[model samples]
Target: MKEQLNSLVLKYQQTNDEKVFKEIYKLSVAKFHPTFNAIAKSLRASVDEVFALYEDVLLRCIPTYTGEGNFENYFMFSVKNKRANLYRDRKLRTQKEVLECCLPKDDDTSAATLEIISEETPEDTLVRKKRADQRQLIRSLLDQTDETTINIVEAFLSCERPTPTAIGKTLGIHHMTVIRKLEKLARNFDSKQFGDFRDYLIAN
Candidate 1:
């Protein structure tokens, strides 16, 4: 696979043919479709989004493909890095939306009031610290879980309209299993803290 991909890349570079580039794209998807699906599931992204990223990576990396090292590894590494970046950007957007909702609207509040609201109060600091501690606790619990369970939890929290059936289908598990695992996981956290943990997981 490595040698073949490298040869195709070399050919594309030599001729700069659109047809050759299309063949490269086709071969890449055929080889890496499973990887694309895995990344999409992990990030709660659609398959199309993952394919779009894959296409972008191919375009960006092909120009620099020196054929010095393993092309497959290089391509996959780029894909994984881009997936991480997409996850980070999504998290940032979620956090921003949450923060925006918490802030007073400009139309309803004066500039002085908005300024006051922007400043963190002592109580707000305390609340933030407590939430951080809760998140740490949740993270520890998650660390104890198996990879499948963690993936389940992430899918549950990140999906826009999450349901046990949908999550199970996405993860190739049964709906009943999804419910059971979720319930078992929820029991690990205190009833009051669970809400904060959910919010923390969703935002982070």
Candidate 2:
């Protein structure tokens, strides 16, 4: 039964025999009409209209069968598409009514709307090249430092709203130790680098 249906579907897809295809489809409808009719009624569509709506979908539905999902699955899927289309069509009609009632008037309002809709500046992109350079320098300097100092420095900067006490608690060190570690980082990396790297890390 499944193999015959599969062959019939393949033939329907490939064969240009309108008479034969119609004949086979009618036979299948005779066998399948009860299921299809129930589904049509559920969609609030007349059976003829439902069949017309399903023409393309039914064509696609052929391949989906694969003898894997049965008639019940196909029936249920067709019904689901019908229900979804009905809901979508209703929503679109409502939207069309709203749009017809209030069409856009002029360029000034359109310009403001465009300004609101336009993507904001891509995040930090203008400074990105300089940021990359700073990050490379930071990474290089830290690569020369001992691992513990590097870890402490990373933990310190990771906090956006950082507090000295919070960082001290995280590193299991005294606030003074945290401060000293940061103060000495410039010396640890390069004895004479820039202005206080410590100030960059400490919240206080």
Candidate with the greatest TM-score versus the true structure: 1
What residue runs in model 2 are displaced by over 4 Å at the alpha carbon?
Answer: 1-123, 126-131, 188-204
All models: lDDT?
0.66, 0.53
Clashes of 1: 0
Residue-wise lDDT of candidate 1 within 1-204, one digit each (tens)?
678888988997778665665567667754677776777878777776675567556655776788899777788899889889988877765555422224556656634222212556575687677656655766677876778778887785557646555678899997556644654565576756355333443332
Pick by lDDT: which candidate is best? Answer: 1
82: Cα error in model 2, Å: 65
RMSD, one per candidate, in order: 18.5, 27.8
Q: How accurate is candidate 1 locally (lDDT)?
A: 0.66
By how many angstroms RMSD does model 2 differ from the true structure?
27.8
lDDT of 1 at 88: 84
**Least well predicted 10-residue stretch by lDDT in candidate 2:** 111-120
Per-prediction TM-score, please? 0.45, 0.33
